[model samples]
Every structure is written in structure tokens, then in C-alpha cells.
Target: MISFSVDFWYAGIGAALIALSLLAFLLSKRLLKKLLAFNIMGSGVFLMMVGMAQTQNDGAADAVPQALVLTGIVVAVSATALALVVIRRFALASVVAALAAENKAAENDAAENDAAEKNGAERTGSDTAVSDTTVTDTALTDPNLNKNGDPQ
Candidate 1:
């Protein structure tokens, strides 16, 4: 009369899913990240299946299921390795590009400072100061200058 059913609850697939979910949560950041989330998720699914195998009838585990787990592990490991290499290369390129952009910004700032010093000298009507070529070039080429100080 449905008096006992603890074994049925323990043998259900929910328990297996819970264990796999825990694993996936832990490995989601370090092993998966943005590139290989699907691969990591597949590995979690494989583990869930393996856990389910523990509840096989007659207390016997099947070889086919175990073999599938091994195959999936191999494929997942290879995919994870390849994705990590690609991500590393991408990060390196990003760093190089960012450094180049920073250097360009610094050069522009220096040029601006030189132009400001030239303007300040001109505003003081000083005739004994050295002429700044960078400021003259900007005054001739830059649209931000006037007809006298920003002559185009």
C-alpha cells in the first residue's frame, strides 16, 4: 500500500542532477568562462549520467555508460585545452593594442603641453623665447588655432 519508498527517491535522477549542478557551479568560472561554457556544461551532463548509472537495476553498472563517460571526458579535455590557448592569444593581442593606444595618448598630451607653452609665451609678447616647432606646426595645420596663433 505504498508504505515504503525511500530507495525510489534515492535512486531518482534528481540526486544525480544535483551533484552535477554543484560541479558545474564550481567550475563555471575557472574552467569555462565565456569561451567554453558549453563544453564545461557538457561535462556536467556526462557526470550526471554517470551518477544515474549508480542506480541501475540488479545493482549492476553497464559498460556502455561508463565508456561514454570516458569518451566525453577526453573530448571535453581537448576542447578546453584548445579554447584556453585561443583565449590566451586573444588576451595578449589585446594587451599589445592597449599599450600602443596608451603610448599614442601620451604623445598627444606632450604635444598639447608644448603648444600651450608656446601660446603662453606669445600672450606675454616675449621676443627672447625660443620658437616651438611643434606649436607652429599645430598652429598651421590644426583647425583649433586662430589666424595668428592658429593660422591654417
Candidate 2:
């Protein structure tokens, strides 16, 4: 009679995980998902290494592969942390760029509106009446004012 053992199951699971990792890495576009797939593939490799180290007759596990797996785990963790840092920096840079673009666009629109108002006043031959309801930006009046509307 043939017997299926724990090593057999581990090997099967490891193979499946590796296959899934490849698929995930290939199909996913985001950095986080790719990192997760890489971690999964590493785990699968570790499991396979352990499974292969199992002795057939004595059923004893080898120490070398276990040590290697432990070392690999540490390296993987370090790599993941570095990758996360890089991703965060990239995300921050993207946000800063987007905000800068938005601020520039707002300044341009304000300039155009001011120019239009001046032209309209010139065409009508009269000074435009400043309405009480018109609210002006603090930046336009006092250069010393900070972004939070606080005096510098």
C-alpha cells in the first residue's frame, strides 16, 4: 500500500504557491501586490527546501536547509522594508507634484480673472466698484501672510 505523507503535502502546497506567485506577479501592476507575490514565492521556495530536506527512511529533518530558510526569511524581510520605503517616497513625491501643479493652475486662473476685471473697467471708462461681498485672498494683499492665513 502506498502512503501519502506530510512531506508530500508540503511539496504540493509549495508548488502551488510558487505557481500562484508567478501569476500574481505577472498580472498585477501595483508595487504592493508585486511585493506580496515575491514574498509568497519566497515562502514556497522555503517550504520546498524544507520538504526536500526530509530524510526518507529515518524521517528526520535536516538542519542546513532550515538554517538557510531562516536566513532567507531575514533577507526577505529587509528587502520588503526597503521596497516599502521606496514606494512611500515615490507616493509622497507624486502627491507633492500634483499639489504643485494644482497651485500653479489656481494662480494662473486668478491672474486671468484679475486681467479680465481690469479690461472691463477700462472699456466702461469707470473704476469698478469693489463689493463688500467680494472676498480677496490674503496672499494678494500681504506677502508676509503664511499659507494658513496667519501673519508671518
Candidate 3:
């Protein structure tokens, strides 16, 4: 029969944490949340390692596992920082692209408005110009008038 010790309790807690972290990572949609889950999982693994190291015997603590856990922590922090930087760059790029598209659309609308205004001014100017001949409404209504508004 195996006797339960403090190490056993730590191991159980560590396993539970690892399982929870995995669940969180799998169900999470956001990158930041996934990153957090990953960190939690790492912590659980470290705890498990510590518990295992303490159970080695004679009540002597092992230095190798402790050192490894320390190194793992440093690596985890570096990785998290890098991930954050990547997310930031992606967000900034998306914002820049959206703003550029908006500005381009605004420029196109302004150009169209200017062109329409110019065309409207030309039409108004042409309508006001005097002509050599003019036709009356009665001439238009009368079928006797030729195509040029003259009596047939």
C-alpha cells in the first residue's frame, strides 16, 4: 500500500492545473487568452516536476529539477513577450490598412464631386448662350411643322 504524502498532494494539484489549462487553451478564441492558458500549463508542469524531485528520497531536495524549472520560466517569459509583440504588430498593421482604405475612398468621393460640379457649370454656361434660332411650344405641338420647326 502506498502512503499519501505532501508530494502526492502537490502532484494532484499540478495535474488538475494542467488539465484546466489545456481546456482553456482549446476553447479560447483570443490569442492573448491562449497565451495565458499556455503560461498556466507551464506552471503546472513545473509544479509537477518539483513534486517529483522532492519524492526522490532521504528528504534531500534535488538541484537539477529546480534549475530546469528556473530555466523553463525564463524561456516562457521570453516567448510570452515575443507573442505579445507579434500581436501588437498585427493589430497596428490592420489599423493602418483600414485607415488607408478610408482615406482613398474619401479622395475618390471628393474627386467625383469636383467633376460633377465642373460638368454642371459647363451645362449652365451652354444653356445661357444666345442662338440664331428659337422654336415656340406651338410649333412643337403642331404636326404640320417640319423636323426643323418650320411649316411643312
Best by lDDT: 3
lDDT per residue (tens digit) for residues 57-141 in model 2:
2447778888999999999999999989977865664444333334434555665654433333222222134332121211122
Alpha-carbon RMSD, each predicted model: 16.2, 14.9, 24.5
TM-score of each: 0.48, 0.67, 0.65
lDDT of candidate 3 over 1-152, digit per residue (tens): 86877776786788999999999988776778988999999999998888877876533677888899999999999999998997786556444433333343455566565443333323222433322221122112222222332211
How well is each residue in 6-105 modelled by candidate 1, as lDDT tens digits?
3334444445555655665555554334335456456557655655565454336667767987998898788778978866764554344333333434
Once fitted onto the true fold, the runs of candidate 2 whose alpha carbons sit more than 4 angstroms away are: 55-58, 109-152
Local lDDT at 126 for model 3:
41
Instruction: Compute the lDDT for candidate 1.
Output: 0.50
Q: In model 3, which runs have C-alpha deviations exceeding 4 angstroms?
A: 1-4, 109-152
Top TM-score prediction, candidate number: 2
The models' CA-based lDDT, in order, is 0.50, 0.63, 0.64
| Clash pairs, model 1 backbone | 145-150, 146-150
- The lDDT-based order of candidates, best leading, equals 3, 2, 1
lDDT of 1 at 140: 38
